[model samples]
Target: MFNLYFISQSTCSILLLLNFALKNVACNPVVRTKSGCLKGSIDRNIDGGKFYQFMGIPYAEPPVGDLRFKAPKPKHPWKGIRNATEEGSACPHRREKRFNQSVPLVGDEDCLFLNVYTAELPRNSATMKLKPVLVYIHGGGYVFGNGGRAKYGPKNLMTEDIVLVTLNYRLGILGYLSFSDPTLEIPGNAGLKDQRLALRWVQDNIRRFGGDPNRVTIDGESAGGSSVHFHVISPSCRGLFHGAIIQSGSTLNSWPWGKLDGAISVVNKIGVKAKTQKEALDVLKSLSAYELVRVLEQMGITECSNDWQDISPVIEYPHEGAFLTKSPIDILNAGEQNQVPLILGYNSKEGHWMNYQQMAAKAMGTWVAPFSWECIIPWQTGIKKGTAKSKRFADTLERTYQTETPEENVVNAWSDSIYDVGIEQAIKFHLKTHLAPIYAYRISVITRLNYLKRSLNLWDKPGVFHSDELGYLFSQSITPKVSPGSPEDIYRRRIVKLWTNFVKYKNPTPDDELNVLWQPVESVDPIKQLDIGENLTFVDTPEARRFVVWNELLEESPFIIN
Candidate 1:
């Protein structure tokens, strides 16, 4: 009897393996990208359907050595088969601290790679019915993030029947910092240029991977959202993609506008003197990529610093087929953008993270005291400019940060001035300019079991913090604390349905079978917030009180125009 049972179990196991293999086509090969023929795989998941996967396809030539700061050019065609089975290396490191331990890994300079995933499994000689493509740009405030970051893997979206693409762009000094020395002509925003090149690559060759070239939807969170905002009006990016989804980011946020001057300042601080423009460019091109990264990292301003006026894409004259608007607001006002369907919104607890950090610093008694009492060199340096603007900003902050105490007030003020005001300005401007259908929402899920399980939180602070909503869309990049299984999981399913429907039909509202008809966002009406709490409801006007406060502040301040 034992022998018979063993034989029967072996037979059953073989049959099961056969069934699984038949149901899923793993790593199928295709011949249609700019980089020659490549292979991909397919699999099924609990939430999504069959998914076709392509990993580490070269989107641009490796930006290494002298090519480091220049806008990425097209990758040269290869002769032999290129291995794309594994994810390509990530760009140089930026800090990501969790629970007081550093997470370090190997990264490379030649990291301009992308991954593609699709729901359709195209058989030989059988055409795949074109599906809407949703290209996601990951957020790390434009300084530190990788498309390879596990939390943002495209598996879930692929199963939802949307073609998904994620690519790595230049970051930190390599991507953003410009050497002002007259010798350097390549100047600023190599990173932003890298993103443009990737989109161009997609426009040129996504159809072969079962994606509709014409139905591409670009989306991002945080800095990624900022990039989407930049691309909207870029002349070089015209007709490259259709539709955009901006989350938790907007135009009114502090951006690095003066590319050439900003680059000069950064390079000068790093001890590079430019006698002439060409000499400056030659010196910059000579520095090793790793040496530059190491030097910038030691400056203490490397990671966790998004200098409002020193670290972003700037308006540049069109050259080599690359062009971008001066600012997002300018594009909206002119209506010169792609004018594709858009879904723009932000989280309800957007500013809580920064507010909490300030509070924590105060509790530890390590808070750097205000500058009014001190003007010594300890707080002032030639590289750092302390102007009337800084003084005014400090005085205003000191006044508005009022809470139970001085410490409490500082935290409140930071949150209000930064995240709150910034997001409000962009949304209001978008509403004022364009007439296309727009959908907006406020994410308000705090401490749900399922969501927390799949996120990366720094301090256990509650509420949907920045990029916290990302996990609801993919299984990658899960926080160690959040466990699976809860009512919170349902939110992800609902969101994927909404987003895919939007990409497919240019509307976030679902059909009869999907059972939800999300109304379009209105300028006067209160937001139909997606409260991810237990037994969620559509509030008449979510955060009505806060909106009034922000709007009132905007009217008083010259910076924000309602």
Candidate 2:
């Protein structure tokens, strides 16, 4: 239990560099960042170890008004010790009015902030020992999500003696929409630049919070995983972090930068149109963020899932001041970026959730149509009756996945269809090009205490979802919390040890504690996969049941050209 003490809000005064000292500290944790001094609260009831949490600290100035659709600027220095103990607003996003119905987009535009959780502060940068750092990015298809969710609380992970950081960035049209213009007015990848600025803040200020800048690890799930993948290849972000953990995502996921010209033509049909590209840019800038996001949502739902390509990171021309200079495949093949230890993998039953989604959409058939959730194809649209293109796609899909239930087959086929072309291909390419350790995993565990199932009227169902690993490591920070004897408690420790081990040292397997020796895939071995489930096992990466058929069809058909 913490010995309770309080730092008066009225008494905080600016301290000069010449007179700065830790002697005047109260029970709360106070550290001076490059931009300003921050005061945070101490937790008394954390099971493993009580820690300090500095919440909603501004890393960048609000990206509103003239700064919209541009790279972030560092927060200007404050005059007094700023309080950083509350959560900040999340980026703007669109929500479905109903299960397949069009809805108005909603969120705030001034949502660029980061949070930090640590055990203690260093008096001086030179003499103090520091711990490894972990920065997490949340995923919602680069369209919807926030970093400060309650489930992402770092109270449990900090027990392993590492610093935890999470951040928010621009989303939807404000973040990823780009056009082919003579002037690079809407320089894409502003969201990624927001992330890069947050990393820079950590590098410059984390030392004061007892984190080593040289030992930082960037970790993310889903689209956030893809963001980390882009950072690995980004030239502007060299040396920003030392390691990466990408779960259930890759650069090839959803948006793989083929041709945006087709997408730009689509953009012109519905949105505020003007005669010239410059006029279009001016018209777009004139619209409010909410209006812009609503228009993008409408457009996204109208197109087929595969061709909804306008809402992701882009391959900018050289010296264009964008995040990715070339495409992800181009960069990975050329080997022209930072090299770091990486832990990447996908969950078992990733497509099970997609199947459920399809079923739900059908059951609620009365709900409005054209409800497009990014990254998920509709249950009925793959087999449209019109063109040869549709027939080829449908025929190949039918051949690839055949089962008792045709609907379920389509659902199960999603895993390989999505990953085989995305994560799986990226990993195979990475092994050939990079010599750094590559530890791939497949998480197949189904939790007994799945809260979503019970709360959402889905009972007795068992499946490991795309983001199910998150609950074991990051519990909902609330009452009736996970108990010490529960499976969640046990797995939390095991998972944290594996991840922090990779951060502290360049290996996931520990030297002292008992752990499965997760061996890295070598040049000779095409597959050495770690399976984390009810029991941990290392097995040959089994070829997906649908791989052969899918591969043959993709090679033969002209529908799905790379």
Instruction: Give lDDT per model, in order.
Output: 0.60, 0.67
Question: Model 1: residues >4 Å from true position, as ranges?
Answer: 1-28, 98-105, 124-127, 179-183, 255-259, 270-283, 301-309, 355-416, 447-460, 477-485, 512-516, 524-544, 560-562
TM-score of every candidate relative to the true structure: 0.79, 0.85
Worst 10 residues of 1 by lDDT: 373-382
Backbone clashes, each candidate: 23, 0
Q: C-alpha displacement of 226 in model 2, angstroms?
A: 0.5
User: Candidate 1, residues 117-226: lDDT per residue as tens digits?
Assistant: 87653442145687788888877766567887475766546557678888899876678755444245465678888989899888887876778888999998888887
Report lDDT (Cα) of residue 261, candidate 1: 49
lDDT (Cα) of model 2? 0.67
